[model samples]
Target: MSEPQYKRILLKISGEALAGEASRGLDFGVIGEVCEVIKECTQMGVQVGIVVGGGNFWRGVKDGAGRMERTRADHMGMMATTLNCLALADVLEQMGVEVRVQTAIEMRAIAEPYIRSRAIRHLEKGRVVIFGCGTGNPFFSTDTAAVLRAAEIDADIILLAKNIDGVYSADPNKDPNAVKYDFISYDDVLAQHLQVMDFTATSLSMDNKIPVLLFALKDPKNILRAVMGEQIGTIVKEEK
Candidate 1:
């Protein structure tokens, strides 16, 4: 078997991706397929870390956080992320993948607290580390949390699995003339205001000089392709 392209990677999966075609909540079919793909990545000797969003369950910033106390709403969103991570971890373990969940917040009963050294140790043991609960702070998106975790773990790159195949000049679903970009720079992304991820997340990635690959989560094989460094999606980087 050929060697994998990256030694370690952080996969940022949105809660919406876990929901698949459904309007909301977990989608077992998608979960199974995603786990299968992750299992394949493990076989290739790649240390994987996952950061899941809570959009399906809740979105503090875009949701009713406007009316509610910002901190409380964000805390609720964090709990929602923990729920998603636990479900994913359970499915992954059932699929024969050794998985450990770590949350930014202190949730001793359900998961271990986010310990940088411990997380790296788990990855070294060939275990998948699932990061939940965002950054343990309000007014922060899970995308930023993913990058923060990636920086902490020193991951080689971030795999941003989204609903679309890649970044576009405009929202493809909304615009007919939108064009797809095979690769884009972080500066252009900000200058053009392309909606790939939150500004905070993109800025963090740029500050750390980490690359992010954006791809559709529809086909499970795409996960393997992205991890294997295949040309599957748009690569967001600091340079052209």
Candidate 2:
């Protein structure tokens, strides 16, 4: 087996990945497979932290949030993320991987509040820390949360898992001829306005000098491969 290049990583995946082929909601089978993949990494002595998206259940921007207040809609989305985090954390625990779910909004009954030092300590103890909710505030994307967590935990890299395999000049799904890049700079990503992540998230990553690996999550073992430095996706970094 190839050795892992990274000691610790923050994996940011959309809720859609957990949904599998379904339009919405969690897919137990798919998530179970994900849990096993993550378990493989922990055994390799890699510390893992994760940020789950809420797209499968709710998105604050959906319907322009329609009639609801912006903050309320955003709160709903944050709650949805907590649901995903809880589900993922439960599965990881079942797989014998020590897991801790931290919520930004302080849901003491279900999860511990997001404390940077505590989360880092968990990772140091070989526990996977699952971050839910978006920085305990409205309007911040989970993408931003992922970057923030990576910075706080001093992670080596951020695995930005998506439905597609890598970063492209245009939407790969819609534009067949769109060019894919094996590597791209964070500055270039921002300048081109690539939708790889929200601007706040991308900027945060750039400023912190965190390497962001954009890859497909459909393959169950991609996470392990990524940590092993398999070059299975596009790597984004700061050139300067």
Best by lDDT: 1
Error of 2 at 189 (Å): 0.8
What is the C-alpha lDDT profile of model 1 across 1-240, one tens digit per residue? 667889999999999999988848999999999999999999889999999999898888768556988888899999989989999999999989999999999989999999999999999999999999999999899999999999999999999998889999998889999999988999999999998888999999999999999999988789899877799989999775
Off by over 4 Å in 1: none
TM-score of each: 0.97, 0.97
Each prediction's total of clashing residue pairs, residues at least 3 apart in sequence or on different chains, is 0, 0
lDDT of each: 0.92, 0.91
- Identify the runs in model 2 with alpha carbons over 4 angstroms from their true place: none
